[model samples]
Target chain A: MSPESEEMMWCHSCREEYDALDAGTCKECYEEASETEEELKREIEDLKSKVHFLRLSSPIESDLSPSDVSLHASSDRKGVYPPVPAHKIVLMSRSPVFRAMLGGEMEESRSGVIKIEDVSYNVLCSFVQYMYTADTLLNEQLACELLILAEKYQVKHLKFFCERFMTSRISNDNAVTNFAFAHRYNSKNLLESSLALILDNISTLTQREDYKDLVEKDPRLVVEIYEAYLSRQVNTAASVKELQNV
Target chain B: MSPESEEMMWCHSCREEYDALDAGTCKECYEEASETEEELKREIEDLKSKVHFLRLSSPIESDLSPSDVSLHASSDRKGVYPPVPAHKIVLMSRSPVFRAMLGGEMEESRSGVIKIEDVSYNVLCSFVQYMYTADTLLNEQLACELLILAEKYQVKHLKFFCERFMTSRISNDNAVTNFAFAHRYNSKNLLESSLALILDNISTLTQREDYKDLVEKDPRLVVEIYEAYLSRQVNTAASVKELQNV
Candidate 1:
């Protein structure tokens, strides 16, 4: 094709001249795609607003009067944190564990007070906040802490949220630790990502302090990791052999 | 280009040979567009799941015990409908009107029982359900009912939801009526859509029974519609003049 003819061609998106190989979509398809993109974006905006609308104002934030239930975060020390006010309906709806505790003929239900032991005030507050809003600002430390709380409470949504955050942050340094945490919590998504990271760095796995700790604390978990690594290797080899035959 | 050369030209999307005039995007741009589409879809899925997680189960369905407040629908009849149970926190969070009634030392707040007058049991139930779930099935009638209830309670989200439904269902048949409803409710979105529909069929508008009623009931609204029509006409005339000069 001549340069003059090439210059005649235009992109519908950026509206610049392009070679046939540089073309994206035809005019009709581009218009259709633009409409679809707009529609998808509008849907995202609508869903976001819905999420905002559904998010309950946190009891702590609202300073709501006459909250039905109060949760106390009891540390190992004698000093107990101030009570975290919440409702039984919200607590039960968010977690089956909370439901079992608050819905049944339990002392917690009767007294309208539940003691959450071994958790700091911050984690307990964040956990309750997440139940109301389905959101929280998370760091690695917060994610790990919240993941434990989420798992214990059986709040699958928050567990998944924290697990996803932790999984994305997984690296060679924390792979073994994350793998162990995932295994303990039964977070399948986190477990897979962490185990894959561990498998990728198998040569340097034992040198990590967490690896030694895992081995001491749970030998079976270490053995299972090795088994997964071996299975992946065998699968890779089989795929390569099949490709060679083809 | 010869017929044989034309055979080489193809669209990546529809997989069809096309002339230069029919050319869409190039292969590289097509691939990039595909990636963008996939990312948008993934985002949509994530948002959808977040919405699902955030949606609180309606109290009616859950049969949750220990509900803190009760809503009674009082019709002028001798028999009052059964009270709809709900949490005060949900009510306050969802509606500013409910918040004021419940949050302050109002009669409802003191008694823990709110008598919602003029709404039937079904509409009141659906209203409560929407407050919890952010969802309710809607037909034209239902949407109208819900929109009224939503506006009365200052539930902006639900009011918007119903307005959108009403707007989508607008036609020449109902445009004038919906326009009046929108004006009454101060629903700006619905008002715009309904007014546009009315303007589009302005030739036959005044002949409509609702238009006559609106003229008799509110001459000011009718005059405003005419003013809007005149402004649009003036704008169109100026645009035409500019095009002719060019």
Candidate 2:
């Protein structure tokens, strides 16, 4: 086709539409643009996917979940959303006793304090790493705030460093007990995912020596876990195949 | 064998040991106890298997993940998990923004200042459901606390209830970010397990439209996610295999 008679195409990268005359350079550019656009779309999707996985992977992934309808009901009746600056939110998180309980897996019961930095693998390391180099040590909330900031800015390395560090110590009891609350808060999905990951550990514990002790200590739970396990689960084809192998 | 010297088998339900213990009601409590104890071992194994399943299923089912290091470094600081909390993590997740984002299937941009929840679907949900239905709510953290209390008190229902609630929402991002800190603070295995799960998600995004976008947005990330995917991923086998037309 003659250049004069050929159609034009738009070049997003160049920000100017050009002629597609004979599959015009414009078309070439648009295809290139499409490749670019397609690439951007893919990146956003990928980042989202990563976030999803990270949320599930966190030890206390159930942070976003809420309290029960009745407990919140009286409060909800007064207002739909809780007040901002979330006084109770922060205060509730600050309980040293709760923290002790939370860290009970490693720490002895409510007899001690559990620093936020101490819990996360990365943040603890970061705090320790930066303690010498940096002037100030980050407090628990500050650490969480920093993590939120890192996430917002797409500071991936920071997120990993922080998240992996913190989630490193999420407990099965923690994952299980907090399940509802995690879903209630702003971070339900991540919490759930993490719990799922931990379930295997808990499941294995059902038969392990440590868990055997746990069962001997709390046979009732072992029984309940068994009932619940039998209720909702369907055998995986892989598992069924494994069964056949056995 | 003669009836006078038959082997005694224990009965599970009645706690009686019978001779070659065929299934039967035993008036002898000691015999029944012996029978029940023997069967308990097998039941414990079954419970362990269930718990194991509970753990693995979430990370596998969640739709999110983390990003690569080098490529994501530019837009990010080479270390940050994504910022936007998974809608599922938010409080009253039935809120408008979530409805819109999830309904629209727009994973890129989150709208409004969404509220966070404190719920979960991990192993604890089932048990927690039975306990504390009114006035008192088991927030995610509280739920975790409750699970611990349950564990301490031998309240198996509460523990598993929390776990199930937690595992259900593992796909959303917000929970992961928030809880990682809590988890890491309390446990180590939970952190590593979470890291592995997030890593798996990162791998899944590659070679798809989302990963392609990462490449376009930041060419450097291309190398990262790709590398991560290649390292951990074996194959993406479909759960249901298609039959070929002959």
The TM-scores of chain A alone, one per candidate, are 0.93, 0.26
Q: Give the poorly placed runs of model 2, Cα more than 4 Å off.
A: A1-125, A128-205, A216-224, A234-246, B1-246
Kindly list the per-residue Cα lDDT of model 2 for residues B1-246, writing each as its tens digit: 443333343334333443321322222332433454456544454433322211211111232211111001122333342323222322112123333443353542233232222222322232222221211244566545544434433433334444444444444252333234325234233334444555666644343564455457666534543454566554432322322322
Q: Tell how far residue B241 is off in model 1, in angstroms.
A: 3.1
lDDT tens string, model 1, B1-246?
A: 654463345677776666567666666667878888899999899888888888878888876657788988887256566788988888888888888998897999988898888878888889999988899898899899889988888999999999999998999999999988899988999999989988878999889888999999999999989998999899999999999999
Identify the candidate with maximal lDDT: 1
What TM-score does chain B get in every candidate? 0.92, 0.24
Model 1, B12: alpha-carbon shift in Å? 2.9
Range of the 10 consecutive residues with the lowest summed lDDT in candidate 2 chain A: A83-92
DockQ of each: 0.59, 0.01
Query: Cα lDDT of all candidates, in order?
Result: 0.85, 0.36
> Worst ten-residue run, lDDT, model 1 chain B?
B1-10
Native contacts kept, each candidate: 0.57, 0.01
Instruction: Give TM per candidate.
Output: 0.94, 0.18
Which pairs of residues clash in candidate 1, taking residues 3 or more apart in a chain or in different chains? Answer: A23-B25, A23-B26, A24-B25, A24-B26, A25-B24, A25-B25, A26-B24, A26-B25
Estimate, for each residue in A64-166, the C-alpha lDDT of model 2 and write its tens digit.
3321111111223334433111111111222333323433454422322323321333343332222111212454354454455344334333333345434
